[model samples]
Target chain A: MAGEPVATSAAPVQPGAVLLRPPTNPVDRRAVGWWTVNLLIGFAVPVVVLVVLGLLITPARFWLFTPAVVIAFAGLAAVLALPRWWFRVHRWEVTDTAVYTRTGRFWQEWRVAPLSRIQTVDTRRGPLEQRFGLATVVVTTASAKGAVTMPGLARDVAEEIAERLTVTTQAIPGDAT
Target chain B: MNGDWRRLDKRAVPVAAVTMVGVAFLAGVPSAIGLSGISVGVALAWVLPGAVVVIAAGAGAAWLDWRFTRYQVGAERVEVRSGVLIRNRRSLQRDRIRTVDVTADPLQRVFGVVTVRIGTGEHSKGGTVQLRPVARATGDELRRVLLARVSTSVPADGRLATFDLGWIRYAPLSFLAPALGAAAVGGLFNVADWFGRVEGLVGWAIDLLAGLGLIGAIAVLVAVTLLIGTIGALGFWIEMWWAYRLDREAGGTLRVRRGLFTTRSISVEEERLRGVDVVEALGTRLAGAARVDAVATGLPTTVEDNKADQRTLLPAVPRALADRVAADVLREEVSPTAAVVLSPHPIAARGRRVRWALATVLAGELPLIVLGVLLTEVLLHVAWITAALALPIALVLAVDAYRSLGHGRVGGYLVTRSGTIRRSTVALQRRGIIGWTVRQSAFQRRAGLATVWATTAAGAGAYAIRDVGAETGLAAADAAVPGLLTPFLAPLPDSRPVTDETVAESTAAGEA
Candidate 1:
């Protein structure tokens, strides 16, 4: 679609019923490995900067190692359990009518968006995701806050999901708002 | 295709120069006063060179900017180019276009021109292209052509609402009065400080109030500030809403036109309007008045420009009138926010509010109390006195807020009301709710309370029912949009008795 992605008139909506339950499908297990690496890098950078500064400047020694040790402990704990915990928490499922997603580790969030409201569907692959041969599918609705991201799917699976969503969305009418 | 570039209206230079000069005069008052010390001839001689440089630079820059600024609607994208030495170009994809709005201020109206803004409805500033001060006919033609696909020519009735001189009664009731008063005082203090005379001004004020005791002086000061605020608020309201009118155009658009010195006409395509927000600030609520705001998708975001409230359709008026207007805007028999029987949040929500309020007060009090003990007895006294004064007010507000918390639905709308200081009751079309976000923090989980947000592309982006009982939030969300949540919820087929059209209305009919 270019220049003018003409939206057809609003088709009647089939008012479907929804229940409040956790999502059904868990993402690829490779996501766990990806998270572990991603988290380790996130924690290591700050500690590295502190250690370098601590060695270079005598004055920084008073505060550097203490923070470095704390970060190290936190990083160690995160690297060990966070991946598995997130893998268990992050789940999603796409149906003919809507998309259901559960994200966030501690403060749980459950989101459900009807397909009629979906504006766009695309697959994103960062370098890290490419390294793991995994891709993430991003679905955006008209609402600024209504973007759902499901990470850690096999690259091919992510592409298929995005393709299916886009096809389904195109058939529905209105501005997908 | 790359089309021929178009320059902004030449009048843009005069507009920019006038505004810049006004700002310069306001900012240069202190320097102007300092210049008074010198003889007029000497001051003129000293200021001539600097003034010449500044005026020339400012005029030359404005002219160059106006000359360089160009906008074009190409085959696939709309682009704008501007700037002098630091040239900049921005473009928005045509396919991504979500809104094309035309607005004309009094200045532009005088020149028979308007501002055309095209956007992708994204939150980022770059998602939009603003073509300021284009010919009025061109702006209208652009809006018509850009949105031609969706236009439906339904012969509209006359105005939905018109400005009444009586509405000014509610003007003084706006909470902006006290806030504006305080802001004025703050400005005065800043101005005094600029002259290094803040202490002297404070001394003079103290001297003036010496006749009264400490409590009397404070009461007098507060009363005076509120009085000033009321006048300022009234003047501002009149200036902003002097000739307000809400109308539905023949081309399936709901248009709002208002403002005195600076007039604005903002139109929302009826198709994009998902709902209405009925706002009643504490003052207005107590006075039995409310304002109506259109909850339409793709309106310009206010975060980038703190200036126009493009969503407001009606100013503070009688609640009944606001409801009537809300109904008219939605094409409903009666507003859902009015007809629905709202279910109040659990009593625990009340307790939570009280606890949060007192906790906040204690946080401030404890720090002061500790500092006072370490520093002086006077501070300790002041801390306890402040706590004593604040506690009851906080508790009352918390209780009122708890009472205000409610959610309900009527017809095809989900009506939810929350907030105390600015209580807003929103009647969002059930179909407009494209998504749901259910959140439960650990403490909220313990309380069996959850916050459910009906996320849509309209007004606030998401309207939330806060601190509702867990089942209440779930049932509301589930009932609001039937099948989407079924797989996630436990198999409670009869969770809620078949209410409304949930099961019966399997037909695919869009909005009424």
Candidate 2:
């Protein structure tokens, strides 16, 4: 249930105004916090299983344990530290005519999608996201890359964005085919 | 019109029998080898019963298939009902039929019938209906009636183009030659292994190679492999394109009839023709030859589908001739691909490619260099040789890729070309472009360039004009598909001072 369409921060102002950077709205601070929780549990389960198997099966006990301990620490460090950088790079904007998303840390990818080509807008909430009161909006175009997903938005915000994208996309003219 | 269901040609039975017999013979080979000690007459007698049983069973199934399998060409749809145990009934809406292709393997040639495949242009498995072994005349008539609306504007049926025997010289230039040759070698080993003698063969070959010494063995191996590859390529070329002829039929359809052992007559509706793609592989480009593929919606894209949708219009012709053919296929005076000189991408694009090439080479060779230093003297020799050869090759390809990046507009089409290994220049109808995607990486942002992708519903679905100036890329996209992207473009920061008049005019235009 959305009211009126609100232009994201990336919307152009007067005809001559410069609006190059995407919207600066960061995801809920809880997203980074949640990812850290998810990361720890995700890594812990697999690492515990692997260590148990290594101790039971392999003869080179020290060799296996050394890498395992090192990997655990490194993984923990990445989970704790990398999300801050990810939070910085991750940005999304929805204009009247298109959707722009800039994300990824090491491989920063900026994608632009003309609203006309968008075939579907899906709002997803997994168990973790639901727990954190967050949702992801996926904009699927006719292109082969499948879709562009912007994660770490409030559930209500994602649903509203999906609704608006659907309305505006439907408003665009049809293709020749 | 036959509203009732009909069966395939009666000749399919004998062809089925013959195929079954051939299969039986192949299956019996190992047993025949085991029976080498027995008398020839005994061996023949032993194998005859099994072959007879297979042929009899196959012939019986073929007869049953002919009886139960039926097709009906109706007013609004063409329906095919098939299968023995599990029934399959597929129907294509008459209006949705995009291609009607007829193919006849060597055995079917003697029987005077062909398999008809009616395609709906959808690349999915369910998009086509195969009518196996129909009378040749019926296939032709079906094709004509199915595509009646397509050729209403054409005055008369005429020949458009035909294969030249001279084109065979370009066969070896294709990557298929070495690829097929390697496959053939691998196949030989596989077949030999089936007889349990692969170990002996490999040992013998290794002994021979060892006698020759490493360098001489390498040289000999390369020479022999190349010889086989070239000959295989030439043979395959003759088999596939021996009597190739392209004709504009009385109705609005372009028909390409080709092949020697297995004949194919594929037709594409004129109404479905959107644009053309000119392809130039590194070897073929070096030889001044190119191929052309059709860009049309509903046409199959899977490699396994009708030999990749049978989209090729001209296979490996002289680049000049291919361009002429591309224009003729589109029924235009000048090929849209040839009418304009493409705009070259920025120097930064070249730098990006060169860095990528070097990175790829380093990724591949680094492990070998490390292993050589740490492990053995033999590996050390290999590492040095690899570096000496790979470095120059990588540099050449990077430069070639940079040279390949270009985009242009010709007539009502937007053309984009790129790639060094498999260069493709697609002339997409400007009207067909449904959307534009502008991408700028952090590095590309610094370099002041962007990749512009024109999205469509046909061909590869999208064609990218890579690494052009950001402003130029956006302007080109807007110009190609007027007004689609203009509303979203953020105005330039410097525009207010430098081009006030133009800015005011653009603002007024935007308001309008």
Candidate 3:
């Protein structure tokens, strides 16, 4: 007896598929600027402290601490700068069976979660983000602390993603895992 | 229902008047004391100002009583129309009420008057609609009507149970022995002087008592300890008796009625409950009694004021009944959730243990150090050895954290157990999480660790699992909710936008 064709209706979305693009609004640009400003402001305190120490301490001790301070600042700046590039490079695809995210510059990190496992989708905006009309969407899964944040999206885009995710997640059975 | 609602007992008026007078008298006591330390004219000045304010306040209270003393309750609602000139009218809807509390002070009891308070979940200037000094019979009828209305609104599937504390459940004798010993030692310091005062008349009697056989002394000591314990137990029993009723009504409404002089009742809807916490205090743990509290959303904000209301639920219950009662009242499968073990990182847990042990060693050696300084001797050597002894205690604590550090899931719920002397076990469902965060510090990043905090709308803040491996934490978050990582991955389709008319219609429907 011949076996029947395997069902492909619930197959995972293709990794290279582009589901949708974020809204091209001035608000999105402002949100990026606001985050940049916050990062700069946070850096100011350490900079002030180091300057004061350099002025008060001896030259030899100052030189000893200066490299460590510069390294620390550079590390912080790198973490802050990486988000912009990550957002630009990131793309998502969704099908009946799975949701996948592909993001990277030199080395890519691709995460594919079956729609059955999708639990909740939440969107939030701080005061600065609100002023810039941008939102951050967070998707949480079953595993502890298993979440990813997507920022710099317009308000309407965030709402649409929330609706689609809710529908797709609800339609799948055995997704609670 | 149409029967007359009698006014508060007339004698309550006199008792209130006496209380007011006493307050006024006490208000002047400090000024009167100050008067004796100053010149005659200055003393008069100090006394006059306070006396004037007290007199004015008393007169104003009396005027308020004369104008708006009477309050009435009907089958549908309670009305308290009071105020001298402004005429403040407050009406409480009987259907909106969650519980009715009736209390009576010693004087009010004698006068056959009761203070009736009707509590509702309405948010306004008047948190509780209160009518003080109503007649005992009227108070009872009012309570019945309010309870009847509230009971109708509750769903039919809930259960009602009453609990009592017996003498056996009284805390074990071991817990109070230390306190009694301390009290007796302190009492010895005062007894010698008392014996001296009556030396001539009862000198022989006092000597006989002091010279009593060791057995007699032991018997007397045992009697005193038992008496104190009995008194404490009686107080606890009385409180338990007064606040013992629990009502589980249909539609998932759970009502807990409790309190002594000021009876407080709380009604919680089933859908709003987030979790239940079973806490055992160090003393209670020794006695094998654990207190249980059901956690819910929209808990009264007043519960946060630790001083005024420490209880998030009713009084503490025995451990045996905690799980059973939670299941019966909440109608949810109750089990142990996650176990919150202390972080076992050497730098964090072991470091704290080392510090504690060192402090203990220092404490033990402090007296010798002081004596050495005074005697100019070699007790300093002993202090050095005492410091070394702390190492073992640090090692023990670090080992304990490692052994105790474990967590697991029970069915669909999570149970977290932690603490050494005072242990806590919290049980919560997976869907109860309102939100969560995964945070990493520079140090934690280097160590491949992160802190995951899950927030619910239940208590004042969030519940957290700290310093877990970053990969494990991420996995746990995914298990908690899969798609929470990217809520806005795909853009939303354009639709008919929200308008003023739609907003108005929704608001109108919500109000209805």
Candidate 4:
């Protein structure tokens, strides 16, 4: 809400002695709905191919369908459940000094990129994400891992984060030069 | 100041001719032996004449190549003009120069000549220029001139270290010795098979061993293989490191000059160095020896460049001596990594390694177990034997891996040690670390542990302080590169501001 620059400012004070500030904003809720549809379509093509092959190549080995069906259903269940769980666990916070990401449910990873090391900040919108009015912010660093992507944000919010990150990174002095 | 255009040493032509003839003979002899109807004497009658022609042609080509290639050393840049058909002219700026490496193979060594490679540190194509078969003194002079800032005498006293004959003992201890021996054996077998001599050779070997018992035959086979491996390893070590010397030139360049047959003189400018890595292979570690590699930008990371000895600061030496060499290179009293008492990682890390090791060993046994239950009793005995051997080995390795995980700071550098098989202790500059990645799996979260990676532009790019307490990992990372991770962290319930004092205290307490 405040237009004051966070760059060069001290870290946001600890809220009730908590060491880390929880993710400041939630992504667009429609992200889960769009992801579920996308995953189902992605999984369906492979499952269909396997079923057709099983019937055509070895009709006597029809029992192959049992494991295939079980696996396909298991994968579908995970895909269906993951987006919602991801939406819940995935959080990002940008400070003057670094950009932080906390993502993955079963495997929680926290990544921090110092502003000085950032090479570029970008906002990407896939067809599926566009349909849901969502976008992803990707940060490129000097390190070989290339870039880190944070998906599931409103298009405008993604643009705003990208712009702010770019400005902050450029403002920092020393290191790369 | 433009210098006169100079050609390669005159002896290169004859050397080239001899090499061509030798190569032709090596190739022709093998095929001559393989040809079913041709006698050795008959084959040589025709092959020798062809070989003479090859030698003559090779000499003629070398002469033309020498005539076409002329290089001029200028005040500001080095200019090389070469190619008969293409007629290309290339110039490298003196200020942009990063390395000047000299190489001399056995033939070149006989003629007292070396090949000089001038590198500008660019990894892209056309970033290096080569001047072949220069007199060894000329190569040295060129190196001195190119490396010098304002033309000062480089003191011979600047030499920090030289090759030790005792270091040869470490040669066979390296994993490469046995691996190379195995490859050599495989290659011999392959060649024999190709020439249809495999059966004959095996039959001979079998006949020789028939006099001995089966157990004696097996023991003799192993002994023979080991003997061959050790000899190969010793020969290789002598060839690669015979005249090894590390020197700090007056102009602040650190250069390595070594080799027996293919002698190499490689140098890296001091400014490019960001840190050093002290690597101890499992066997070398057990022998209390280690090697030092430089962590620097613009030194090639490409696989081919590794064979060129791009980053080796010191070859295998006593761990203490390697540390001293590292410190000498950095101009520090003691290398930061070796000096610090690195904090041990959480017990959860050990638990994780043990679990993974057990699973891996079990997975290997699972196939044998299933096959045994379904079909054969012999396979069941094999499975039992395999499990009995593998499980203990896996446990020991897991414990070694756990013991290797530690991280600490010494002044301006952050030091982390990890790995069991190729254990590395990297002392990287704090300023060089550009980012941090704090990771926690569900299992790690349950145990309140995390792996924090410090990402930099140098070395393997990311070195991790694995599986420490979540808070400790963050604090160490934050302290290493101050004001980097603090702003991004979510406030914790028991949050205390991670100041330098607290970080120092935590490290002193061994991150316990």
Which regions of candidate 1 fall more than 4 Å away from where they truly are? A1-19, B1-7, B27-29, B35-42, B69-127, B135-152, B193-199, B492-512
lDDT digits (tens) for residues B277-373 of candidate 3:
6666555655666666766553444432231132344444566666666556545454353222323321333344455556766678899899888
lDDT of 2 by residue, A5-101 (tens): 1331234443323223444467777788778877888778767876887889778767667777887997889898877867776877787767777
What DockQ do you compute for every candidate structure?
Answer: 0.28, 0.17, 0.05, 0.27
1 versus 3: better lDDT goes to: 1
lDDT of 4 by residue, B448-499 (tens): 5677888876666677888876667777887888787766554432334222
Model 2 residue B307 CA deviation (Å) reads 5.9
Poorly placed runs, candidate 4 (over 4 Å): A1-41, A48-75, A120-138, A152-177, B1-23, B36-98, B107-157, B494-512
Docking level of model 4: acceptable
lDDT of 4 by residue, A38-126 (tens): 88877777777778778887964466677669769987897878788878877777776677777775666767787778878999998
- Per-residue alpha-carbon lDDT of candidate 1 for residues A1-177, written as tens digits (9 for 90 to 100): 112112211232213223355566799999998999999999999999999899988887969988998999999999999999999888888888888888774577878888888998989998898999999999998887758888998899899999999999999888877
lDDT of 1 by residue, B49-129 (tens): 555566666767768878889888787778899887788899988766766767777667777778888876667778778
Ten consecutive residues with minimal summed lDDT in candidate 2 chain B?
A: B494-503
Candidate 4, residue B168: Cα displacement in angstroms equals: 1.2
DockQ of 4: 0.27
Instruction: Tell me the lDDT of model 1 at B107.
Output: 65
Over B245-294, each residue of candidate 2 has an lDDT whose tens digit, in order, gives 88887666788889999999888777677789999988889999998988
Is model 3 an incorrect, acceptable, medium or high docking prediction? incorrect
